[model samples]
Target: MNFSSKLLENAVAEFARLPGVGQKTALRLVLHLLNQNKQEVEQFSHAITKLRNEIQFCTRCHNISDTSICEICSSHKRDASVICVVEDTRDVMAIENTSQFNGLYHVLGGLISPMDGIGPSDLQVDSLVERLKDGEVREVIFALSATMEGDTTIFYLHKKLKHFNINISTIARGIAFGGELEYVDEITLGRSIVTRVPYENSLTK
Candidate 1:
């Protein structure tokens, strides 16, 4: 698509680069921002810049944070004995929104998708193993999406952690196969977490 102004074209291009954003939507967003006051636009730009520059990943869980460790990881109130393993920060947000889980999280960053050239080494799997070595965590909950890639990731992790004498479980199949946790209804996701099944049982199906 052609724009009369090069500035408008550039803004639209940048917006379109984001996932799920099309050229038309990008154009609309750029036009909307053009209608806003200069100060408001500057504020928007500054906010994005500040977020990119200041955001830090939690050293322990790999979740996005303002500090080296996230509030959830550092919280004394959270159950340190249980760790819910998820694919990314978005899944963390989804689970947190349900308020059903009081335990901490381990964000793997991404799953084991060999077709996409993502393997165990591509994830934070080694860090998770290190976390389990001390016998502090009693349970590891696989709260990843109910997809094939999710299953592959879970299986690989279970194999790595099996020797630790810790309980290993996965969120109930209340979530549809291929359904992302972030998109599942909160009620279903909450129920799944509350009624999880053993990792061994997950292998049967």
Candidate 2:
């Protein structure tokens, strides 16, 4: 197969770099983009560029935001005393879609995966501990995945935060094993929050 166009190859290569996109899918996407009108292509490129340039991480919750603090963190309607800790901004969006949690959030950025070399220090765990120093927070709800890495991170956090009297809880197992909060149904996610268990007693009988 003789490759003719460098531009098309570059576009396919770029698309392939995205997570879960294979060479075939990347080629298909590039062809689809090529079929679109010039104005549509320009708009797509502009949107991608704008997302990279305008969006930033919220200094407080570590969620993607246009400002230092996200709108959720600045909202007076949310309960500042309770923080729902999630693995990523996607999880935060998933929980927000349920509208069941009225508290603030803390995005850990990622989980502790030893095989992937992602340790507790690699995440925003220290920031969470610092946030608790104010004593305004009464609860930290762990909404991480149910995988082994997730369990390990939660246990580490529990031990680190044991000195604080605040309640530490984990979302109920309504979410199946290996289930990601981003993919769980809204009703199941809401139910999980309603039936969350105390983290301290999770390992106990």
Judging by lDDT against the true structure, name the best candidate.
1
Write down the lDDT of every candidate, Cα atoms only.
Answer: 0.93, 0.91
Candidate 1 achieves a global lDDT of 0.93
TM-scores, all models, native as reference: 0.84, 0.82
Model 1 Cα lDDT, one tens digit per residue, 46-119: 99999998889999999999999999999999999999999999999999998889999999999999999999
The weakest ten consecutive residues by lDDT in model 1 span 196-205
- Regions of model 1 farther than 4 Å from truth: 175-205
For TM-score, the strongest prediction is 1
81-173: candidate 2 lDDT, tens digit per residue:
999999998999899998889999999999999999999889999999999998999999999997898999999999999899799998867
Q: How far off is residue 139 in model 2, in Å?
A: 0.9
